[model samples]
Target: MPYKAGHPCFESGCAKIIPHGQKYCDEHKKMHPEEIRNSSTRGYSSRWRRESKIFLKAHPLCAICEKNGRYTKATVVDHIKPHRGDQELFWDRDNWQALCKPCHDRKTWTEDKCPVYHY
Candidate 1:
């Protein structure tokens, strides 16, 4: 069987083919240099860890999985909107949602086509 086609580069109008596991093709990946950064440098630091722990405690079930009638434990606190470098949006609790790892990855793959860069 022939291999299935891969996804287009996440960069807008970029026709470069890339694997599902990657966000961008080699050329465009340079434009998204922050993608290679460590989690702590991307605002997932000690403060975020502490706050996300509290968030998960308050909302122990994945919102999407719960909506679909499965009771998955929420381990990730996702920003409903990509906060990018916006400090205000990053800290907005109203823009947050509780999600399991699978649910969070699915949402990111489908919805967050643009990667969020922490400045």
Candidate 2:
């Protein structure tokens, strides 16, 4: 099949066309090297996925929802304390809580101090 030109670089105001199969132009890609690295390194790893699956299997209900008298099924294993990319903290089962997606999102927003929407 003939190669189709990709969309413009994701970086605002960058008109450079990205090569097929690439998300960013060469210049923007270079400008955000840390983002590329963090994308690969940060968040849940394979081990985390395995462990979280086991955890959720054992604890199938949202901890926060339980406290509020709700019975939501847990879908995420959240760290009680912010792991901040620390492997030890990330893997600490004692620091984990099984949370439903809404509870996890609410907890994260509260912990991150994200601005509340008035609507």
Candidate 3:
């Protein structure tokens, strides 16, 4: 019997048919060279990077500086809760704050230093 749409042509397959271009289904179509490489990686994809650039452009001024009445340009997205061991917290959008390069570096350096060992 001929395979129908949403029916797999081969055994152990589960994909719908695409009449035009590639015959592979939606999921299979996404497995193409560019899409395969793009889907294989995780976190902060190129699209995310582009979105960040757009965000910086939209809100050029630092959100913190604005709150403090400083009006400085934003340059970094900082995590409120530092991700020491858990990488998941590293990209928590809700836990992020926008800071200028200077402020972000200062905060990061401060966190890196051993307060107990330093005078």
Candidate 4:
């Protein structure tokens, strides 16, 4: 059989080869434990869905759109400040706002800077 292919280590400037279906090799994994946990464990759950639905009902209009006078309907409950797996902040109503998917995506891309781009 041919040899299995692998990718370079995710660590910046590291050339260590690691198997596929992983974000980092064993060596660099320790430095990024935060990336190990899946999204549900990070805070989102069934309860979050229910609460977000209720929140959307109560705040039907998108906060960002309302500010811009567009009156678009809200389809997502966005945390004004990132909770970053903090349960208290995750459940904090004061830190939540209703947003359309587009505005939420834009805010997340601009503010959170997740999936940091290479170029």
Candidate structures ordered by TM-score, highest first: 4, 1, 2, 3
- Decoy 2 TM-score against native: 0.63
lDDT, each prediction: 0.87, 0.80, 0.60, 0.87
lDDT of 4 at 105: 98
Candidate 4 C-alpha lDDT tens digits along 6-116: 999888898988887777988888766567777688778899999999999999999999999899999999999887767888999999999999999999989986543
- lDDT string, candidate 1, 1-119, tens digits: 87767998888899888876788888887788767566777688899989999999999999999999999999999999988767788889999999999999999999887666555
Models 1 onward score TM values of 0.70, 0.63, 0.47, 0.76
lDDT (0-100) at residue 13 of candidate 3?
A: 68
lDDT by residue (tens digit), candidate 2, 3-91: 78688987889889877777678777875543456433865778778889999999999999999999999999988987656677778
The collision pairs in model 3 are none
For model 2 the local lDDT of residue 74 reads 100
Question: Top model by TM-score, which number?
Answer: 4
Model 1 spans with C-alpha error above 4 angstroms: 1-30, 116-119
RMSD of model 1 against the true structure? 6.0
Residue range 40-119, candidate 3, lDDT tens digits: 15345676577567767766887767888898988877666664434467556676677899888887788744322211
